[model samples]
Target: MGRRPRQGPPRPPAAPADIQLASDPQPDLEHEQTVEAAAYYDVDLTNRLAERVEFFQCRFKKATLAGSHLAKVRFTDCLVETSDLSNLRAEKGTLERVKLSDCRMTGLAWSDGLISDATFTDCKIDLTNWRFARFDVVTFEDCNLSGADFTDADLRGASFTGCDLSGAQFHNAKMAGTRFRTCELEGVGGIANWEGAIVHPDDLLGLSYVLAGALGIVVRETDR
Candidate 1:
């Protein structure tokens, strides 16, 4: 019998219409503050430092969170679009029911974070760090994830589609039920720990070579 096809994660719910528009041009975020049900646009929060902050049912459009350090933060039911989130470090953070689109997120580090029901689309997530993170029902589409590190991460509920995963590291990571489709898999590290992960048939040829290299197997032509 052939292998059974795996299903992708369910899509997250869209934002509610009742969310209020923020009267302020920018949000005044302090440590351990919880901001909810507000819509912000063009807020410049670059290089800000805060801890244990929470955002619920908030929408950020064209906001700049670049180089921010928001440790132990929580984000739920949020939509972030066209944001500059490069080099932002949000270690030990929690993200649930969130979606990010058309964002520049390169060099972002979310180590030891918990992410659930999140989707990232058309984002530049290259060179990011997700070490020791846990993902549940997370999906990435049309994203550039080259050189991202997933060492010791739990990716059971993660799926990638139309993404660039070149030079990504998955060393000692949990890969059960992880799915990849129409994604680049070149030079991906930690092929030895890819048990129970599903990939499209089109990507099998590249993945086979990666597996061979990990096993130290060389393919050579034989004379007839």
Candidate 2:
């Protein structure tokens, strides 16, 4: 018998209580500092450097973490909205039960990271680096992931819907059971590694073109 069908929609992050807001609304994040049940709005953490910091049950709105080096940081049960995480380097970080919406994450580097039970919606994730990352129950919807790198990543539990993934690189990636729907697969790299991925019929044309290019097959229109 075939493998059991993967579960549907991932679990969302737990809602944080308003009463649990941090005493200092804009608390500084330090190395190994753990913050829970807090809300941060419009806080600028640009170019900050921290290691192994953790955030739980937290909400970040309009917060800017651009160019920050947050290596090995962990975020659990968190919601991030309208945040700018562009060019942030969080290598080997962990993200669990997190949801990010309307965030600008272009050039963000999450390589060697672990992301589980997370959802990214309407986010600009172009040129992001997810190399050597592992994803479980992660969903990306209506996100612009063009030119992103997923080399050596494990994506068996990931799904993309209505996402612009044009020119994305998937070399050496493990994609068994991965799902893609209404995604732009034109110019995607590593077509040979897509053996077990599930793609919507509507996306086959673009995927076929990419596959053909990889196989050195050329197609031409014929006059009727």
Candidate 3:
């Protein structure tokens, strides 16, 4: 008998109430502070270094985290929508039950991080690095992940639906129970090690061609 199907991504944490809003010239900017149930709008956090900062039930809208280093940071029940995360680096960071929608994540590096029960919807993740990262029940829905790197990442029980994963790398990754739904896998690497992964039958058409080329196999017609 085959293994049981993995469960879907866990639900996001509930939004907190009575959260304090950040005022102009935010004092918490670049400061190692714990802000809970807060909403930050249009904040400019460029090149900020946040170490051990924790944000719970927070919403960061149109905020910029470019070139920022977020080490050991925790974001729970947070909604980071329409935010710029370009060149953002997170080391040993954790994003649990968080949703990042419509966020620009190009060149973002989350290596050696823990991302559980997270949803990255409609985000641009091209050239993003997730090497050595561990993901559990994470979903990348309607996201552009072209040229993204997931080498040595543990992506068990993760799902990518309606995403453009062209030229993505999954070398040495743990892909147990991973699902690919309607994703563009053209030019993707490490397709040979997709054991226990689930894909639609139609997806095999594209994947087969890639694997065939890698193995130098030629297809010829023998019947008229």
Highest TM-score scorer: 2
Candidate 2 per-residue lDDT over residues 1-224, each given as its tens digit: 23343577778888866525455645567999998887778777788898999998988899888999999999999999999999999999999999999999999999999998999999999999999998889999999999999999888889999999999999998888999999998899988888899999999998989988998988789779
TM per candidate comes to 0.91, 0.93, 0.90
Question: What's the residue-level lDDT of 188 in candidate 1?
Answer: 99
Look at candidate 2 and give me any clashing residue pairs: none
Which portions of model 2 show Cα errors greater than 4 Å? Answer: 1-6, 17-27, 222-224
What TM-score does candidate 1 reach?
A: 0.91
**Which 10-residue window of candidate 3 scores lowest in summed lDDT?**
1-10
Q: Which portions of model 1 show Cα errors greater than 4 Å?
A: 1-8, 11-17, 23-26, 219-224
Residue 64 displacement in candidate 3 (angstroms)? 1.0
Candidate 3 lDDT, 54-161, residue by residue in tens: 888998999888898888788998999999999998878899899999999999989889888899999999999999888877999999999999998887758999
lDDT of each: 0.89, 0.91, 0.85
